[model samples]
Target: MLFVGGITLLKNFERLMEAFARVHERQAIPLVVVGFNRWRFENDLAFAKSHRASAHILFPSFVADEAMPQVYRMASCLFFPSIYEGFGIPVPEAFATGCPVVTTNRGCTSEVAGGAAHLVDPFDVEDMAQGLELVLSDQAYCQELIARGRARPPTSASTAAPVNPWIYSSKYFTKLPNRRGPRASLAAPWGISREPLRQCQTYQGTNYMLPPGGVMVDSPDRGRYI
Candidate 1:
């Protein structure tokens, strides 16, 4: 089975659908897409219909985090041809779960793949299709990617503590005063609300604080806070 994880506009679901259609025409491989967004969901549904791939593609939106490892393990390869990403958490997540990846040749996704993925041009539907076909048909190549992925460093915050101890340390997350009262002044130097900081504190049940005036963005893919 072919798998595409984390659907979003920037995730380039359109190109993936088109490519999957091409591959399906020749092989009839099933494509499972996991994730959800109202606008993206509707648009992707239309795109799949237009490509004549709606019947072969499965959209099981919003898979729980606890079950994601099983999804990855079941997948022959995780197609993540995102046009943009802060860190592309799914690449590492897939790696950790023994799933080979097919991701964009550029940007953070490639970096996250770290030579373990089948790199494809996200803008080129044919390239994406060929990459998918190669991974699905070539068992040796697929095993090579799985071996490389298994050798990659741990990506989750909890497992990365040995590599970066500060990630789990108390100093990494600064406690900010409440924003609704006089204590809000204490957070004035950072010029950000307590809610954002609180989000960092609780992200993945780990503590992470940004520097003064630093911006904290929660990646839409699996709440990968950075």
Candidate 2:
């Protein structure tokens, strides 16, 4: 199994570790946790040790972007049960790399999964353990998820164009700072200039925004662009 996120409260790493311990009790599965934050590393490590799961969990700390695909391909499934996210990039990344996903039933994760993943309640440890077991034991179901994931990206990409103008407008208005503000130093790196940015029709009740030149896409409250 694999998990990708920093050791942050919002990422819900502790709950995942507890759930993994339950799964490990039944089967000696090695879980690769592929990100870390300094603030929580010691506490997370202590929790793992307390659960007797330290030996089974690997904290890789950081993995290079170019090597992420290989990491995803090696895992049986990607576990991403974040409490909240602006958008969940790892879901689609796992999808594109043909890794089955077991993510949260709520928030942007369920939307990104597009019914192609094994959804579990993030707060329910038993449910999460069951999700992990099902994905690991059911070969047919795993393949089905893989097939659906492979089919998801293209359809999502084709529908993302309508949101580009929204992205441009939102980023210009919200992310860019005035010429003399404290964040003025960020302008050059982000390619911001004095030129007037175009405004696009706002898609009401949506939180979608695409970075300049980013290719990943999604729908309103149902998909994401990364």
Candidate 3:
């Protein structure tokens, strides 16, 4: 079974669907797409129907928190290739549920997977398909992933929440006495090398980072950290 969360473009739904079209030809692996985003789901379903792959795709809308484990239990693997993410909670969650994951190296998925899951390119359909095939074809590889996943360390309490602007800002920045101003520290994620960050002010009392290459921040509500 292949499990994906949403139909959003960034989640790489279309590409996963394409890969499944190829995967189904090799073996009829069932796809379970869990989400409640109406417009996006409709769009992705339309694409699947057009490709004649809808028969193999199952849409289960708005799965509750308690039932999520059972959902994970039903799957042989979790397939997530998000182009970006605040952090991939599902990666660790899947690990906890004893489900091996095939995810992208994009965003924080790799960080969260910690080498437990198969990492693939989110952009290329064939690469994604190959990864799927590899994990499914090799019991040794799948067991390695599951064993490593079980042994993988839990993410930090801060990481329990999605990696957000607040992840970089709230934890790293300190406010001066009498609200003199907000100052961001050079601190990076734990065990990471710290770099120098110039002083900057907060937006609406919320600290954010504007890095050298580009200004980026994660919205806790939106789930994208950019």
Candidate 4:
């Protein structure tokens, strides 16, 4: 199964949905999407339903924190082709869980993916579809990506450099609290320490401490998420 976690317009749900539609057109792989609800849910669903691929997409919006690691373990790969990202937590979360990642090259996602992900164009459905195909069709390549992800632990030195610019410029994190020592280990239920999620910051100014990150909401006007 393929997984795409989080919510946002920048996350390119429509593009992902359409790309999955194309993937389904060629093969019958199911997509498991986990996140909060979106305003375009009905429209995205309608589009996928029209393509007759709705049944192949699963949306379990609220997976308890206790059960999230199991969700990642079940996934064949994690697809997060966002047009913009402050720093994608899910990419590393999947990486930590030994799941191959497929994300966009744009924005902070590239920085956090740390050359361990299958970078794709979030704007191009065909490109995203091709990424999906490559991951699902090439077991050796997929395993290689997973192995690389494992080698580069979330907060390890391997992932510290090449930080995304948004890591400091994000409007959501404008009021970030100061930190002295290394951040506390923020692990999910299954010993998966979520480090990249530290970069997420919502505009509403909600506190996003600890693992698993915060609930993301996209602003239609700015096309940014928090």
Candidate 5:
């Protein structure tokens, strides 16, 4: 079974369904389009009926999130050919569940997949056909992707959050100053290379780096120190 989502203009709904229709003509696959918005649903239904391709088009808009796992499990792969995205979270979520993903190469989708998913041009029907064929025809390749996805590390949020100042200092500031200041020996308590100072120079009570002279003194705080 194949899962489809949404019918918005920017969602590439028409291109996706058209690709599926072409693929199905060659080999029939059960497709269920999960939809929202009653008017768009009705319009899609009419389009499907008029095209005489209603057999494979099933609309199940009421499925709950908890049951989405069963839908993912039932399918061999998830097909998404969106033209653009800010960050494609669902691609990784599907990967976490052991479902192989076939999505477009644009936007953050490619970056998120990290070679775990097959990428194709969303605007090219032929490329989409080839991608679907590759996955559905080759069981070994599909399993390789699934296993690779399983080995992928979980996302970390600290990447975006403000981290402790000490961590940044310890990791990067460990390097010695290129040129020492006049009183580098005394005022710079992190002495030449001796006992580490709990705190470095401060500009107006704020932590700052020592000047080129590497001198630490009671001089008035300057804005450049920061």
Candidate 6:
């Protein structure tokens, strides 16, 4: 039995149902959709009625995490072509369970898969078909990935950098302001640019001189140039 699991969005659920219909034509594989919504299946009544193998489509609302290993063992591959994601966790989990993964190459999915899974453009149906084909038809490639996946060690946490809790705390996370506005003027004393002015005064009644440190600091308090 082939298993499809994820948040049951209407569009994705419909595609999964249709794809199963098409694939069942070539091979009589039963599809058990775990975590799918019953409302979605009911709403697509007409489409479901016209499906080639409606009986083969099983909708199980929720499956526990502990049972997922058994689910992966029961399937040939996991077909997950989500439209978008920030960081896909399911791909890694599927790979770790010794299941071949075929998913979209959107967002950080490519980085996560790391050539361990078959990738395809989410928007291209042909690409999705090709991805499915590569996994299904190419036995040697599929076996190679399964081996790599089994041997692949778990990844390290991205937020493992050493942070100074005393210097910067969680409170600073919410208080950051957007820097799109004009930059504030520097608060240091203005230095003489053209020539070194030990003590020179301009019409504005300010002094421009090279400081002891030879560093120039722009200042708004002193008006005249010296």
TM-score of each: 0.69, 0.68, 0.69, 0.66, 0.63, 0.58
lDDT of each: 0.69, 0.70, 0.69, 0.67, 0.61, 0.57
lDDT of 2 by residue, 96-199 (tens): 78999999988888887889999999899999999999999899999999999987753322123232222112222343333332211111112221111111
Report the number of the highest-lDDT candidate.
2
- Pick out the ten consecutive residues of candidate 4 with the lowest summed lDDT: 160-169
RMSD of 5: 14.3
* Candidate 3 error regions (>4 Å): 157-226
Q: What lDDT tens digits, residue by residue, belong to model 1 across residues 55-119? A: 88777756776677788899888888888876666777788778998999877887777789899
The sequence of per-residue lDDT tens digits that candidate 3 reaches over residues 1-226 is: 6565666877888888888888889978888887656457777777877876789888766677667777887788899989997666677778877888999988888888899999999999999989999998999999899999878756542323323221222533334555533333322343211122222323223344444443445421221223
**What is the RMSD of candidate 4?**
11.3
Clashes of each: 0, 2, 1, 0, 4, 11
> Which 10-residue span in candidate 1 carries the lowest summed lDDT?
179-188
When sorted by lDDT, best at the front, the candidate numbers are 2, 3, 1, 4, 5, 6
When 2 and 4 are scored with lDDT, the better candidate is: 2
Residues 105-199, candidate 6: write the lDDT tens digits. 77666777777888877666666766676777789988987877666544421111111112123332332344332323222233322222321
**What's every prediction's RMSD, in angstroms?**
9.6, 11.2, 9.6, 11.3, 14.3, 18.3
Model 2 clash pairs? 218-224, 219-223
